[model samples]
Target: MNCTPIVRQHPDGQSINYYGVTLFDEQSSKSLKGIFTSWRNLFESAPNTFEITGNFVDWDNEQDGEYERININRDEVVNQLGKIISMSEHLAKGNCYLYHLGK
Candidate 1:
């Protein structure tokens, strides 16, 4: 799986940069969703700055066998959250979709 940041401009004139995580299977998708939901408040806050402390799976790495997992430190989460919040501010008013590209 590969995690990439993508910036997209919509027809309506709104632009957003998505923190995309590619899932190879259903399990991975579910796991990712759970993580998002778990940190819903932090992501939704749109803080100019913030910090996170926990062990998170790093999607940038390759896994072995049936399951793959990489540990994401606190710094990485903070960085990713910052990007999401910043991009979200660019969204048109009343549009609540958190941009994410999955494949």
Candidate 2:
């Protein structure tokens, strides 16, 4: 898979460049779908499918993305959830975003 460029466009029209890329596979995508909800909720903007702008990340609560997966095995989901929580924490600090690329 090709790496998707992650950039943040500020309200002033200036874009901030990020050094690394984030990737998600088919399994990970399916896994995340349970947490992100519908397209209207997660993909609010057209032509920018994998982008999560400041509009969604502007919140102060890091646990805002939490969801209960009662039937799912915790061992399989723990690592991913931990990483997501870490990312949420980073976004909570401001001047950043959560983005990824997939097939």
Candidate 3:
């Protein structure tokens, strides 16, 4: 399968609008999980997640005396997203269920 850009961002001076560009895989189910994976990978994470390279705190949202959530790096997340978008045929066929654990 050929790879394509799954996201785009429109810059406006100091802010950007993130958008997803996706192509449905004929053999896979178009569930929310599938689409959300791509979205999270493309923009919902910081560029430097593990402090390995580049700016680490640029996009991360730290709690102001609220809850503590660790920062996530985008590169690793994107790699996983690639796996999701290009999911194996065998995986798609597994009888799996999606459930909400908490309200």
Candidate 4:
């Protein structure tokens, strides 16, 4: 498969280079870097398909703010949260560790 190079400006006005080497945006070239890695979470499947959520919570260690919060299980959430952070830093936005691809 052959792919043409695609360039677009990010929301921050920074230019991002994507050199397609496989098919469309499926693969990139040595000269360019893509928004997110194609491979991420391919084991645990979730509803949103992304491990991260939009729900914002200011984790202020200080007691001045909200004392505590509630969500999914603590241990489970902590584990999933770690994966989410690592994945988000790699992917652009839409995609996340919430969904799995394959084994």
Candidate 5:
């Protein structure tokens, strides 16, 4: 579950998961959604924030343009996604938060 550059241990004892490093546009949005459809509820349920310590966004309130999509090799993402999920489970406990920065 240890991935180089993806999960880096900070000096402050914080584990940084670089799952959102990929940037995607409108074109890949559909494809990305297709891959993540199964985890839609999990993602939509998690709390999200625009900044590190900003107000949380109401997932139900936002209609569109809420999150960014990823455009990458389909197979590559599939593999990385699995790794990230495992890492999350191993690293996180009760409530985990998702951070989103729109384009």
Candidate 6:
């Protein structure tokens, strides 16, 4: 499994910037889904600053993997609760941009 953290701007400037995770396999996708589900409440509490989306996308010419996008405000992440806070910290330590989180 591999996880890469990335930042993406909203097209047409319609929404806030997004933090994304590109997972290389089904196992990584499932694991991340569990973590995200466990923190769903924390995410829901801040609708504007936190959001999650998952989809399958081509990883290369012959493979596909899960792409998870989390819309976040860096400042607001510091105020979140529980494991969500820790996860945010981990991501931020990678500078909130393109960085590898797992392999």
Assess candidate 3 and give its lDDT.
0.43
RMSD of 6: 15.2
Q: Each model's TM-score, in the order given?
A: 0.31, 0.28, 0.34, 0.21, 0.24, 0.23
Error of model 5, residue 65, in angstroms: 20
| Ten residues in sequence with the least summed lDDT for candidate 6 | 1-10
1-103: candidate 2 lDDT, tens digit per residue? 2222232332322222344334333323333434433322333333432322233332458656544333433333454555664565455455664564321
Residue pairs with clashing backbones, model 6: none
**Best by the TM-score measure:** 3
lDDT of 6 by residue, 1-103 (tens): 2233222332442222335323223223333434554566555565566556866565764355566786887345534544543554454444343222322
lDDT of 6: 0.43
TM-score-based ranking, best first? 3, 1, 2, 5, 6, 4
lDDT of each: 0.41, 0.39, 0.43, 0.33, 0.39, 0.43
> Per-residue lDDT for 56 in model 1?
45
Model 5: residue 27 alpha-carbon error in angstroms: 34
> Over the stretch 4-99, how does candidate 5's per-residue lDDT look in tens digits?
222122333222334434333333333434444445434444444222333335565765324444333444445566654554443334233333
Better of 3 and 5 by lDDT: 3
Taking the tens digit of each residue's C-alpha lDDT, what string does model 4 give over 24-79? Answer: 12122321222222222332233333333443445655444442443334345446
Clashes of each: 1, 0, 1, 3, 0, 0
Q: Which candidate model has the greater lDDT, 2 or 5?
A: 2
The positional error of residue 15 in candidate 2, measured at the CA in angstroms, is 21
Question: TM-score of model 4 relative to the true fold?
Answer: 0.21
